[model samples]
Target: MKLRELALISSGINERRNPQGTIYYIGASDFVAPSLLNKLIKPSIMPSEKLEKHFLTKQDVIVLGKGHNGFVGHTIVDDSKPMVASSSFMVLRDFHVKVLPKYIAWYINLESTQQELRSYSRGTALPSINRTILGDLEIKIPPLKIQKQIIEIDELKKQESKLTTQLDQLKTIQLELLLKNKIKNYEQ
Candidate 1:
C-alpha cells in the first residue's frame, strides 16, 4: 500500500522563536538517527496561540523533509506536553486502522528506504523530500500482530547496542587501570 493511503502526510510549521512561547519546537537538531530524540538540549520555544493546529499528537510519525544526508523518520511516542515539528519535517498522522505509526517509522528508517528517499530528493545543494514523493512511496502492511513483534524486536536490538557500548567503555577503563597498577608495581 502507498503511504498516503495509510496516513495523512503534511508539512510541519514554519515559525520564528518567541522567548515566552509555551510550546516546544522540534527541529532537525533535536532528532537523532534510528528513531531517537536527543533530549539533552531543550527544544526551542514557539508561541502557542497561532500554532495550535500544528501541535503534534501521540503516534504521529515525523520525517525529515529537507536535508543533504537523506531523510530520517521517527514516531512520537510522547504527547504529554505540547510540541510541534519545524518546517524541515513532514508529519504523518491519522493512520489507517491496519497500520501502526511505529511500523511506518521503522520502515522509513530502513537503509534501503533511506536510499530510495534520497533518490527522490530534489536540488543539488540541499536535497529535500517533499510530501508528494513521500506520499507516493510504497509501504508494506503486514498483520498488526507482526507489526507489534517487529517493533518489540527493534527495541531489543537497540537495548543490546546500548549495553554493548557500555561494556566496551568499562573494558577500556579496566585495561587502563590494570596498566596503571602494573607500572606502579614495577616502579615500586
Candidate 2:
C-alpha cells in the first residue's frame, strides 16, 4: 500500500513524564533499540508544555529534526513504556491496520526516502522538514506477514553486528599480546 493512503496521521507528544518524572533527551549516540529502545542517556528534562503532544509509543514512527536533517530518517518504538521526544523530532501516527509500523519506519530510512527528505528540506543556513512535508512523503509496504519477516531479518542483523564487534575486540587483544611477547623476546 502507498504510505499516503495508509494511516496518514501525525504523532502526539506525551503530556506527562515517566513515574520518575524525567524527560529523556535523545542524543546522536542514544541506543535506539531495535524493535525496543533498551537504553538512552537522560541528558535533561523537558516541561510538560514543551512536550505536550509529542509522546510516541510501541508502534509510532519517529523522525529526526534539526541538525541531522534527513540523516537518521525514521524508527518505530517497540518499547512498551511511553517516552517523550525533543523538539528536534517528529512522529507519524498510524491511521490504518493495513500498514505495519516497523515496516513503515524502515521504509522511511531507505535510500529513496532519504532522497525525498533531502529534497523536502528548505532553508538557506539549516535544512529542516515541516510536519506537512513529512506527512506528504510516500512509501511502499508489503502484507503483515512479510513485514514480520523483514523485522526478523533486521533483528538478526543487529545480533550479527554485536557478535562481530565482540569478535573483533577479542582478536585485537590477541594481536596485542602477541606483539608484546615478540618485543619482550627481542629485548632478551
**The best candidate in terms of TM-score:** 1
TM-score of each: 0.92, 0.75
Estimate every model's Cα lDDT from 0 to 1: 0.88, 0.63
Over 1-188, each residue of candidate 1 has an lDDT whose tens digit, in order, gives 99999999989988787767667888888866555677664546756576788899999999998887668887998887788989999999999999999999999989999999988889888899899999999999999999999999999988999999999999999999999999999999
- What TM-score, to 2 decimals, does candidate 2 have? 0.75
- Give RMSD to native, each candidate: 1.6, 3.9
What is the per-residue lDDT of model 2 for residues 1-188, given as tens digits with 9 covering 90 to 100? 44556754553342333445565644334535433444645525545664645555556666665554454544654444435655566766755786777777777767788788878787857787767777777666678899889877876887999899999999999999999999999999
Best by lDDT: 1
User: Which sections of candidate 2 miss by over 4 Å?
Assistant: 1-4, 8-21, 27-29, 32-40, 46-53, 68-82
